[model samples]
Target chain A: DTAVSQTPKYLVTQMGNDKSIKCEQNLGHDTMYWYKQDSKKFLKIMFSYNNKELIINETVPNRFSPKSPDKAHLNLHINSLELGDSAVYFCASSPTQRGNTGELFFGEGSRLTVL
Target chain B: DQQVKQNSPSLSVQEGRISILNCDYTNSMFDYFLWYKKYPAEGPTFLISISSIKDKNEDGRFTVFLNKSAKHLSLHIVPSQPGDSAVYFCAFGNEKLTFGTGTRLTIIP
Candidate 1:
């Protein structure tokens, strides 16, 4: 079984439109995270949820919001998408909150292109 | 500011040779260091990790070395195989990992 899976592997949309990417983990991890890989290939953390509660929120735009319905699912919705938002979004999960074990399970990334 | 950086964008190694990828970070508070290998269109898979308290950890053909004083981390693959060709990322932190850009390793057959 796949430990983590993401939907909408590739998305092409016009600017100002709204789009959402969904991620689910069957590994029974309690901590999940969202990271954006920019054009420079830098992976930056956007948000993190631990047991359905928001924990880490980096310096990101307000247009982006993350929703965690349960410990297994985390969804990302972007409002008024911009061209600069074109990047690969990765969803990851760790077994513990602090990840003291130093391991993470990631999903097949969702590539979003805003035209 | 980018806390982690991968200076080398790519690296190439021949089959049965050795492959090394390097990473540097500016923060020293990280208690754990990790390496992840990613294939095309696939998410990164955990390869190896070393705690800040230790200098090295090995697993199969993969090994990770952490230099806390220098804030440097490196991944080594011995007898590199074609299957080892992929992008490798170095990350550090306890709660939230800060990842380097990534180093693309190409193992020639």
Candidate 2:
């Protein structure tokens, strides 16, 4: 079984269009994260949720919002998407402890392209 | 600013040679370090990790060495095979994980 999965593996939309990517993990993990990989292959963390509580919110733009309905799901919604927003978005999950040393299990990323 | 930095963008190694990938971090607060391998059209998978208290950790052909004083870490793959060719990312785990720009390793047969 796929440990982690995301919907719409490929997304192509015009500039200013809004889109949403859904993610789910079956790893029974307590923490989930959203990371963006740019054209340069630089991966940066965007948001994180631990047991449905927002934990880490990076310096991402306001147009990006993350919602975790439950511990197994974390979805990202982008508004007013721009050309610079074109990149690969990855969803990952990890077991959370008081001092977490766990590794992340990532889903097949969702590629977003803005024209 | 990028806290974790992998200076080499790409590396090529022979099938039976040792591959050394280096990483540097500026955050002294980072206590745990990890290496993740990514293939095309796929998300990264965790490879190996090292703690600030330990200088080296090894698993099979993969070994990770951490130098807290220098704030540097390296992943050494012995007898690198073609299947090992992938993008390797160095990451630091604190409240969250921060990744470095990946290094693409190409194993030549």
Candidate 3:
């Protein structure tokens, strides 16, 4: 089974349009996160969900929203996508083991392009 | 602000030599640090990690050294192989793992 997966591996849309990226993890992890990698290859955390509860939310723009209907899935929706949104979005997950050092297993990443 | 940072954008090392990658973090609350390797068109893979209590951890040819006081960590690949060429990312783990800008490593055969 694929540990982490994302949908729409490549997305290209015009500016001011709306789009969504879906992600799912079969690892049964309690925690999931979203990260953005820019053209410079700098990865930055956007949001994190733990058991359906939002945990960490970086100072991202208001147009971006994350929805986790269940522990196995987390989806990102972008409204009025701008050219700045053209980058790779990655989804990762980790098991809920406190005091245990857990590693984030990332998905292949969804590449979004806004023209 | 970038919490975790890899100063070198790229590094080249010959096969059969040691390749060292350095990372620095400013957050003292980070209790765990990790190294990830990524190839183009693929997700980053967990390489090695170390906790705050341990200063060093080794797995096969990869070794990670952590200095808490200096907030520094290094990944050393001994006898680097040609297949070891990839982008290395260092992360500082808190509620979420903050990644660095990544360092592209090339191994010359």
Candidate 4:
């Protein structure tokens, strides 16, 4: 069983379209996060949720929103997707919020391409 | 601005040699550092980590060295094997982890 899993391993959609990527963790982690890695392979945290509560919201655009129905799941929904949004989106989970004992476990990643 | 920086894009080392990957961070609030190894099309796997309280942590052939005073960290792999070839990313944990751009290491056989 996968500790962290994501849906839509690959997605291709036209610009202005709306899509969503779902993530779930089986590790019983209390905190989950979303990260975006651009074509240049630069990774940045977009958002974070602790026990279904929004914790950290980076400088991400308003078009992107993260929803956590439960501690085990976090989904990202993008509205009016743009070409700049074409990148690999990764979901991660940790037991605590930046605690010394916590280490983030990442999913396989969702590759999103906006044409 | 990027908080964590891996200046080297790639590195090549002969098998059985030592491979050293370096990373620097501008944020002083980051008290925990970790190294991850990622293969193509797969999620990153934890390699090693070191807290600011400690200067070094070792696991098998992998060792992470932290220099808090210099705001720098390095991962050293001794007797590098071909299986060690992968992209290595450095991460600093505060409220969230900030990762470097990643450095691809190739171990030549």
Name the TM-score of candidate 2. Answer: 0.97
lDDT of 2 by residue, A1-115 (tens): 9999999899999999999999999999999999999998888889999999998888899999999999999999999999999999999999883487758899999999999
Model 1: per-residue Cα lDDT at residue B21: 94
| Model with the higher lDDT, candidate 1 or 3 | 3
Q: What is the TM-score of chain A in candidate 3?
A: 0.96
Q: Candidate 4, which segments miss by more than 4 Å at Cα? A: none
Model 1 / residue B51 / CA error / Å: 0.2
lDDT of 1 by residue, A1-115 (tens): 8888898999999999999999999998999999998898888889999999999999899999999999999999999999999999999999998646668889999999999
- Which tens-of-lDDT digit does each residue in B1-109 have in candidate 3? 7788899999999999999999999989887899999999888999999988899999999999999999999999999999999999999875678899999999999
Evaluate every candidate with DockQ and list the scores.
0.79, 0.71, 0.68, 0.69
Q: Estimate each model's TM-score.
A: 0.97, 0.97, 0.97, 0.97
lDDT of 4 at A112: 99
Look at candidate 3 and tell me the lDDT of residue B82: 91
The C-alpha lDDT values of all candidates are 0.91, 0.93, 0.93, 0.93
Clashes per prediction?
0, 0, 0, 0
Q: Which stretches of candidate 1 lie over 4 Å from their true place?
A: none
Over 4 Å off in model 3, which ranges? Answer: none
